[model samples]
Target: MKYVGRFAPSPSGPLHFGSLVAALGSYFQAKSQRGDWLVRMEDLDPPREMPGAAKLILETLEAYHLHWDGEVVYQSHRHELYQQQIEQWLSKQQAYYCQCTRKQIKAAGSYYQGQCRNKNLTADNCSIRIKIDAPVTEFVDLKQGKITLPSAIAAEDFIIKRRDGLFAYNLAVVIDDIEQGVTEVVRGADLIEPTGRQISLYQLLGAKPVQYLHLPLAVTENGAKLSKQNHAQGISLSDPIPTLICAMRFLGFVLPKQIETANIDEILAWGVKHWHLEQLPKATQITTLFSNRIS
Candidate 1:
């Protein structure tokens, strides 16, 4: 592996401070290792996407000097590929469809009891779920230490295709990462619970699993994370150098006072050369420093 990394963000809105932290952390780590850092636009769920958010995100990244190496991968364009993988899984009887409603799962209390496991049903109004194997319980994470999930959760049948005819995030991400040959994944810590499921998917697909790094969440003054739901403002693309410097500082980087006055390119050049992953906080949440100015 040549240290290929990707920052895949959902295009639900502009890149806010929280998302910026994620982007910068991943970007610096990749560049620090002298590796390729790529970007992928996760615009699979059309109903949840904003009209111009994708373009705005790219423009913002460009302003911040977080340039990507290859073409931006859009999940919407890969639906057919997901279908092909789903068909292969179905052929081996490794996957099945479930028509169970949310109301039913809520009553189970623990995990899906596989009510439709033996049911011979078409995937029309049903969601396709993967049959979880028990042994994929734990794996090494590049950031976090060894983790364990309940066997019920580890082996619980999870969805691959939604009843709404949309491909599930897990399946699509797995396919894209494998096909792209991504070697490392860095993202928010909230996604830790689903890592095992994704690892299982990689094994099922006979694809190598990428090293995982789940960073802490960026919380606000009120403790709620800065997100579209919380009305967090996007990072100002105007004069992004200061924003980039501030972000690097927030990630626990200690630059000479002179570099604080450095341009974005200079700051990033310093960043890529001195990036450290060991300094990242392992706590559940991180207090984000938001600013209105580049200085």
Candidate 2:
């Protein structure tokens, strides 16, 4: 089968170096394979989204010459699609309604310990959770190798639709990828922990989950991963090639120091020719030189 990969970015803030790595890595991996590479604007959570961040991200990727094959797919416009599948899950009882809040889950240590599993509650100002059973706990990642989830996370019921009446990332991503017919996922390793949950969701929904490749995360000096939460600086789109090349090098590309100085088109052409998905670091957390070194 032909490869179909995607670069999904949440527009909570401007694209930073860390997210750019995932974007470039996924884009190159797909383009290198002579497959369709798509960009998905993961703008589902409207509350935290920055007004211009989506446009900035597109501009940044365009400046880097990472052109996508089709029109960009925005999550907000696909609410009906999400809702259709969500309703299917709801009808089958594969999902259950939960009334647990943040404090309740945190009191049980962040992970949902399934307090409302037997409540059989109605869906009101209530979130929907998938009932995990006899989990297919272990899966093979192209980068991270065999990953096993803790029994707590593996068997624990997880949120699919939030109480606030919006879909959760796990549910939305699975639905979108399945509907988009994505074959492989190449993204940051920080999301590796959620793979098990995502995989479980797909199975319960009777869809084939894409092959996983979790790229290493970029962390800051304080040893925290780059994010708006960590205050990582936004990637300057004014001249994106060098920084993108450096990011590829950080991921262990052998494209040489010269590629780092090339024009955006030149760098992307070289990167597409030389990119290898296997060389990505397998660790869950990695300190990023680009995060700190970029002035």
What's the count of clashing pairs in each model shown? Answer: 0, 0
Model 2 ranges off by over 4 Å: 108-110, 291-295
Highest lDDT against the true fold, candidate:
1
On the 0 to 100 scale, the lDDT of residue 172 in model 1 is 91
- CA RMSD (A), model 2: 2.1
TM-scores, all models, native as reference: 0.95, 0.93
Q: Among these predicted structures, which one has the highest TM-score?
A: 1
Q: Write the per-residue lDDT of candidate 2 for residues 1-295, one digit (tens) a residue.
A: 8899999999888788888888888988898899999999999899989899899889878877888888899999999998887778778877788998999889889888878877889988899988888676789988777988777778878888899888889888988899888999999888877888999888877788899988888887678888866667888767666687678877778876677666778878887898786677656777766743323
RMSD of each: 1.9, 2.1
**Tens-digit per-residue lDDT, 50-84, candidate 1:** 89999989998998878999999999999999999
